[model samples]
Target: MSKSKPTPPPATPTPREAVSNAKLEELDQNREDSHGQFLTTNQGVRINDDHNSLKAGERGPTLLEDFIFREKMTHFDHERIPERIVHARGVAAHGYFEAYDNNASLTRAAFLQPGVKTPVFARFSTVAGSRGSTDLARDTRGFSVKFYTEEGVYDLVGNNMPVFHIQDAAKFPDLVHAVKPEPHNEIPQATAAHDTFWDFISVTPEAMHIIMWLMSDRALPRSLRMMEGFGVHTFRLIDAAGKSRFVKFHWKPLLGVHGVAWEEAQQVSGKDPDFHRRDLWNSIEMGAYPEWELGVQVVEEEDEFKFDFDLLDPTKLIPEDLVPVQPLGKMVLNRNVDNYFAETEQVAFHPGHVVPGIDFSNDPLLQGRLFSYTDTQLKRLGGPNFHEIPINRSLCPMHNGQRDGHMRQAINKGQTSYSPNLLNDNFPKQAKQAEGGFVSHPERIEAHKVRARSKSFVDHYSQARLFWNSQTEVEQMHMVKALRFEIGHVLQESIRSRMLILLSQVSEDLAARVAEGLGLAVPSAEGVQINLNVGADTDPAPYQSGPAKADTGRDSALSMAVTAKANAGKESIKTRHVAILATDGADLEAIADLMKALMDQGAQTAIVATHLGSIKGENGQQMLVNGTFQSTASVLYDAVYVAGGAASVAKLKQDADAVRFVNEAYRHCKPIAASAAGIELLKAAAYPGATDILDAEGVVTSDDAQVGELAKKFMAAMAQHRFWDRELKAMPA
Candidate 1:
């Protein structure tokens, strides 16, 4: 017994240890032979002459016994799932939504009840790209949300823009085809600035409004959380009293609206195609939950014609100044999905999924979406049992007589599978209206069957002009720049000229400016018209005409300048990322104190060393470098801090990236802070003198208590987002 002592008892693994062991086991299971192994059939019989595939001879005809090759080819041929026709390239997150206030009077949706927390899944996407395409494409972002309420799932399938390219769903496929890469070459991916896209816009004049929006900064949003979401089509809200009202749903971001410039957007794509996705994921991980306030514009059923534009037109939008959006509740995204394919990819959203009080309007585009979504899921998910997927499944109990579909997850226990059966006591009975069941609003309808669009839907330019008029001077400049860039890419002169003519209908100044940029003359329009048999004289040209007066003040809401800071009173540099440009022998203690104070206020500080390694501080303390001067640019940071020592200043003077970093920060109107030693570095970079340079407005010059004061001032300036008052000497006059 002593000679054959029992082996020591094996130790039980901790949770972390178990995970590590499981990973090791997985690796072991995946281990393959380094040297070539004998080829074998499915039945484990080794084959000596595998290359011959059981043929009669090396050069003779192959035999039918080569089942291995046949099976391999069969699996290879069927290794793809049908991609979503739209929203193919998408990123999704899991979150929860809590209503700020009760919206029972508006709708009886349980999720909108005050204090009721409902889990939500949101998917952001690019419309035209395939599932495998890059993320940072110049395209509209689909902002769709699925709310798993106690009642059922409510889907708000919307886009970043408030309006769509087409008003009618009949033209949806055509629009998508035109914007998609040309079928022959498939040269471009996730772009609309091509011959086919321009050609489509040239013919469809009604697309002008959305085209203008697409060409603007909105299409290149800085972040998904910074953009607004809208249910482009009008829908109906039926109250408990059976009172129906025409409504438009809107999701206004708490961060306010912001966008990246075209040049920056392009550069970001190459630098990081996952820039937006990473920003969202990191922000959520860091506890900066994205939030949006839900608002709705309600119009009585009888007052639908009160607006100058048709409410049913998907291309039209009701300006907030006109009817005003009544704030309903707020939605906060506080979670991230654990799995992409199992959750994000498998989740399906349909506009047809409405609760008891929500109903659809007569918007033709919406009517078509109702049919298209369910049809797409059947093919994309491989069967009708997609609802069984965890992401798409409703939390509420579901019962139905239908069963035995492909990939069915549930097992029916009862003998009866049909409704109205006496066998199972008819347990799954239909719910009545009193039981919070869905019911379509009954309304009188009388119209001749026709394929033509309504006369009211023809006006496309007045709102475009209104939008143009409302923009601030800076926004208008950006819009002009956008127009020039998009039209400049047009290879065909006819397409450019046609677009200019359409622009002229929006604004004469805009048309002339764009025409001048393209080196083309603006063409006079003969006034296009759409024929409708409504017996009323409807001229589409009048709709294409710009507003009589271009001073509507709608631009106030359109411009980000007006909505930059959510809380004006509490404006501080909290959460702002500041770049500290430093080198060896920099003011370590002062920099440390400033950074600590910033971090205490929720700000993030990153040290940009001359190189990517440990840098010696002024006190001979080594600090781990966060980034290099060349790798991290000033454009990526909110503010710049220069705390150089004599040695560091001399070293920074020779570095071009260090010089450019300070200069670019100045050019972008960001706050800059410098110590006495840092001033010489700034002078070497030829930074223009500012009032804040010597005065304690934003810049710091002293190493005393004034340094802390200067840091506070700079932080306040950073919260201002931008300093437009700084003169732009580099701009062309």
Candidate 2:
């Protein structure tokens, strides 16, 4: 009864409280309810569709009038401060691009003309990792080059992988958010092996192709100098006559495509978090410049729809087997940054930064990037004057009326800030198309305003199957191991089971193998909602996927093994690191001759002993030790050589670190060379085939008389990159 009396109608808010209550109610109306409510803009305007940006048509270029996309992308681009939302961790070098020949028919880009040496600032980065993250993370590597061309600055922002995770740009934010660390816990930094990432992949069927790449050895590059780069989106090459051809850009490393083992990558991450960065810096310091041949896969406009896949789909790639890559030029990264923060950290790359000839396709992803990149630079580099930064400044003259912002570097002179003003007589006027000015290809587009994906981008698993079929058995096994490790880390049984179903579409063998590792059965695809982007009221039948299409079954260029064979030659071993295990009383004559022979072949040699500093040779001569057994691991070098001397061999046999070093080198399938008493050390370390060391696949053994032959065989073995056959018998180091 007392409680009933006290429960008089709730007292009305006081005047001040009422006013604050009114404001709270106002904010409550603005707050979005994500449960059953429709998607809306930040301004609370209901969105008809949020899956695709407004385009001229289903397959047409994205229209600039799309305010929804602009606002959404503008928010995504500024989500992080100071560092980039993607590709935050990076390393850079000063270099130059040299054209092979003048072929104006393909493109009129001035930098592509023969004999022109255009200065370029090339930056390499790992996506999905912070600036402080380890460089060896198994993720997509960013390969962006800012070409300071005579016309203007052209940034070829691409990745080591030829394809992307999503087909449209509208889902870019979603893709990034899922791959990033979970919002609630922020665990598992610099990796995609988590429930959130797998959850997104399970629902997004279009990501099948990129998921294959991510779970391959390509995700763990052996060195920055050895990985290939690709412009993921299909672009256009416009000639002077305005002829447009669909083209895919490529950067084939001169050192050839190579990757470290998943185990090695993990170890390197812990041992040297800056493994790739240090390798790039040291190689440059040693005057061993990294080089890559600029290649392009050109497709005629008329033949765009002839292939089984769509050229405008970013998830699909025009295989080199289908359309051969043509060599256009060479890019050599020769100089290290003078100041990392000033040059490397401040450098901004945008796909929209193109010269006259290079232009964009209607690829939805690229179209979204065109708007996102400039917006990203605005927030990250502080305002709109980022182009004024010395690292990003164009060599060509800038005459736009635009001026003044945070960190403005240029000092403008006249009072005529507006265009067409009589004050300056339109001094900085726009040039005609023929006055070496930029002009877009006059391609006609006809369609109605729409927010939908093209039917052409529907088949998501064909190219993924093609990639699986193209991989060698060894490579496939490695991919299986990678998938096992990644999916195994996913704690959610539902997510893991869903991913297995998705993999079954790619290859039954792949899904089965990965399923076996996870101790889970491959679930049936039936009853599973494969596509989550469909509107609640819309029919999900059209969005659901069917059987994967089969076009080109396999492409050899997709396999690193085939690429290594194609690039095998004398130049293959150039800039390779070789560790020489030596100690006091080592063979002076043999060690000196071996170092000279290896260096002559462009291979760097480092003397690793039980201790640092000079070690006394058998002849009482002193030799400097570049590193110690405790200081360096076999993962730091490409090959190992044990010096021959009774005393040195005995000392190495008794040292646990030295024994482990040789064992690890053997486990990694790297070349090993030993001479006379050094063979005893190999046997003691239990290196594979040590009893028959001379006949081992990657081991070279010799007495003093055959020292020259030993060096020759070792160089050949090193050129092979790795003796993968030895992997079957490898033991954990």
Candidate 3:
């Protein structure tokens, strides 16, 4: 009977028909509204005029009957919620996470189960800034992740850099207060280059390692997706067998690590304060999901004393070369949040929020974080029930006898809320460790209450010196400049000298250079005392050695230069914004092919024309301008391409903006491409004999094929990110 009904031949769509079908489907999904449509109220009543509202007369007192005006005012009156004191400026996204393999041996966390995909919400933020602060500020970025698992919500609240400034949690407030703008003047909005910060860092020698990192390029990440994240504290990984191991969490970005030069970073802040945020948002929106691999370095309980530094020291890090990282999983952010305020703003992350198999260590800084995060939320989020917010809510069912508080969204059914109640048959019983419940490690301990830090935690300069010796020459120069800038801003000369002395303890050369810049003599080293109550003084001299010579063959895992060079070619240059400078009459064919090839390869191409309109091509075609030269600068792009037409070359040669664009790009060491006509313009602008002219080097030329080839080579050079080897003679020393 089924065969009797002859099956119709399979309908195949023609190429044009398929395209038309797609257009029709898109049009159906998105309907256009008529321009003449009348404006309506929320109730759908067409309004003839809304300007005057429901007034008695044109100039008379407005009546209370104006429901429209009342509704508008009421909504506007309550548009804000308390902003986070730290990590106030943040961007969030939704994504899924999958473990590389079963991590049951390391921990029993369900999300890290083999082949199991868990949904995650991650929020990246800048600390010590307001909601509207510039994203390019040299501040620590918060890398907080909320995993919605079957067990419960696990928040890995971390920072971009692995180490922290203070060793103890008790000093967190003091450290934060000193770094934040001074209470009296409030001069700096989101800057740490000031007197109070240097003063605090000078006293807290434990901050040396982190301070070195802060001054380095790590603080100026080119994009959020290019930065590494660290838990910043030693955590306990409890296995199913109750074995506890100290673990430090790491998030290695798939794009590798990259940073903006200080000059470029500052310029980007002025050009686009939302640079990082926009980069992330656009990447995810375009299906280029940002990814990071989760890794952990575990230290066994028996080997706790095998290292030079205390395992409980939050300021220390076990070098990756010494203790290799075990990659557990990969997190790919694929979705953007629907509502920023409800999701990004309301979501809360606490280092204390842990599931089964995850426990805390005695790291003093972490102990303080446990208290600070919860306390901060109470004040910032306006209630204890912040967990009820959709973004913060646990995926697993939650039940407790706790009574309602402000903004409570749950309603309990039973009258008897007690757990040991016969009336309700003890419905919500607590699960034991045997039944997949969270349990603290049973480590036997005995201690006398003390406020002092361990003597073993006093060797701060060794790692600081390690960091100093590890940097590449270019990175070292940046660090020196950063120190000069930060210390230069200090109003008090004494504070600057104290910092310079501290710098000398790290490296005499570094201290001397910074001191010279600040017009101060490098102060003598002040002996750092370690009160271990031993027979002899445990002086901090062994670790106070300055920079290791190039021949010393010593390298530290703490340096960004080593970290960056470690993953050089692996970084993706996709979606990197490159501004192509052009005018009305340019090499339209060469520009078109270069732009198309780059765009197809996922690199963003923005046409920077003299004005925001159509520019004539060599073949009589017209190209729509993406941005005007006045609205953009060389710093806004990863690289610059000077491909103008013969007709436009004369004007470009005389144009100050054009000259500045080329000069800035050259000074920044960004890769530049030029056609025959564009080369004339470059020559007019004094193209140095040593400069790597693409045309003379057989890289870029008039032929379309050569232009395409040049684009590929230029992209490879752009991926190098910078041409630091370029002799920038004109740049200020």
Which candidate number maximizes lDDT? 2
Instruction: Write down the lDDT that model 3 would get.
Output: 0.76
Highest TM-score among the candidates is held by which one? 2
Global CA lDDT computed for model 2: 0.88
**Candidate 2 local lDDT, 166-258, one digit each (tens):** 888988998999989998788879999988899988888889998889888899899999999999999999887888999999999988888
* Residue 332 lDDT in candidate 3: 95
Candidate numbers, best TM-score first, in rank order = 2, 3, 1
Please give the range of 10 consecutive residues that has the lowest summed lDDT in model 1. Answer: 50-59
Q: List the residue pairs that clash in candidate 2.
A: none
Estimate, for each residue in 325-387, the C-alpha lDDT of model 3 and write its tens digit: 899999999989889899998898999899998998767667556655776676667778989
Per-prediction count of colliding residue pairs?
1, 0, 1
| C-alpha lDDT of all candidate models, in order | 0.73, 0.88, 0.76
Q: After superposition, how far is residue 481 of candidate 2 from its true place, in Å?
A: 0.8
lDDT preference between candidates 1 and 3, better one: 3
Q: Of the candidates numbered 2 and 3, which has the greater TM-score value?
A: 2
Q: Candidate 3: where are CA atoms >4 Å away?
A: 1-81, 526-568, 684-705, 727-733
RMSD of each: 16.7, 5.7, 21.4
